[model samples]
Target: MYAIVEIAGQQFKVAKDQRVFVNRLASEEGQEVSFDNVLLIGDGDNVTLGAPAIDGAQVSAKVLKHLKGDKVIVFKKKRRKGYRVKNGHRQSLTEIVIEGITASGAKKAAPKKETKKADAPKAKKATGKADDLKKIEGAGPKAAEAMVNAGLDTFAKVADAKPEELSKILSEASSRLAHIVTETWPKQAKLAAEGKWDELKELQDRLDGGIEK
Candidate 1:
């Protein structure tokens, strides 16, 4: 029998006693781990598939070891600009051997509910006209919402932001926003806050998705 399971945000097809290397897991070596996000289970000609993920299905494994993979070279350069950067990275990985596969009975743990004080009023959402931060090249709806939630609702506030600060906000917002290039956001926000549409247009024209050409 074989099963397709998700382990540490990556998927793998695994079977009994099969060893697999996956992204780093928090569990220590010799620890037992179980994944509840089983996608499919197959035995001979019979197969069971999940709607997104099968409820109560689980795959258990024992962590064998933790190690780093081969180094990867990262090189960047700007043509004729005398700009070059080189780096290397080795991926953290964990080795595990599948021990068992259960088609049911292993359920996800329920989150505990926090009880609030009876007299406490609910927190109010931020009010007032939110600036159109999406007007900035790299700022999508989610990114704009993140900035708003971080109390940066006005163009002036965004204009005063540092690239590192914006990067932190986006990183906390979502994984999708983590890769955004924030170098141009404050400059764009400054132009917009000052009502310099012609200048903003000219600058955006020279940019591609908030990145300098």
Candidate 2:
């Protein structure tokens, strides 16, 4: 059997158990990932092609290793000027072992939420609660939690938060996501402070390149 599929925004024809090198993905060696952009499938004498993408078809693969591809030498020269430039490039790659193909593709599912379980110790409520706060629009859960721990729970507090204040507080926590707080936290706080929710949404859409609300 042979199938046409898309991987990492590029398309190729593949078959079951085939080995292929693709652009590196965020997977550890020996991990697995699935691809659904099976554009066409053929077995024996029967073949099917999608108008754009094949519906209800899937391909799965396992990463055998992460590797750097063969070096590509680039040389540029201006014959009359005696100028030459040479460079070598190595593309990051993942070596994959095709697992199997399924005609019925996997359905997209909603992301899982934190589950509440009785008998377990009651989880501490997040500290970053602000008056009139609905959601911190661009904040991730851990970042929000850090803000709560710092006693700046509400959007109102965040909006008026001086860069120096946040730097001082979060600097003691962890430096990994510190830059994000400096960049996105102040803007989010301002929106919350002024109750300019729509304006904040507009700014987010602009930054994210989304169509107008």
TM-score per prediction, in order, is 0.56, 0.49
Q: Clash number for every model?
A: 0, 4
Task: Residues 62-111, candidate 1: write the lDDT tens digits.
Answer: 99997778979889999999999986656667899999999989967776
Among all candidates shown, the one with the greatest TM-score: 1
Candidate 2 segments exceeding 4 Å error: 78-82, 109-213
- Candidate 2: global Cα-lDDT? 0.65
Report how far off residue 167 is in candidate 2 (Å). 27
Give the range of the ten consecutive residues with the poorest summed lDDT in model 2.
Answer: 204-213
Write model 2 residue lDDT over 64-140, tens digit each, in one string.
Answer: 99677787988999989999998665666678988888766467546535563233322243433444333554356
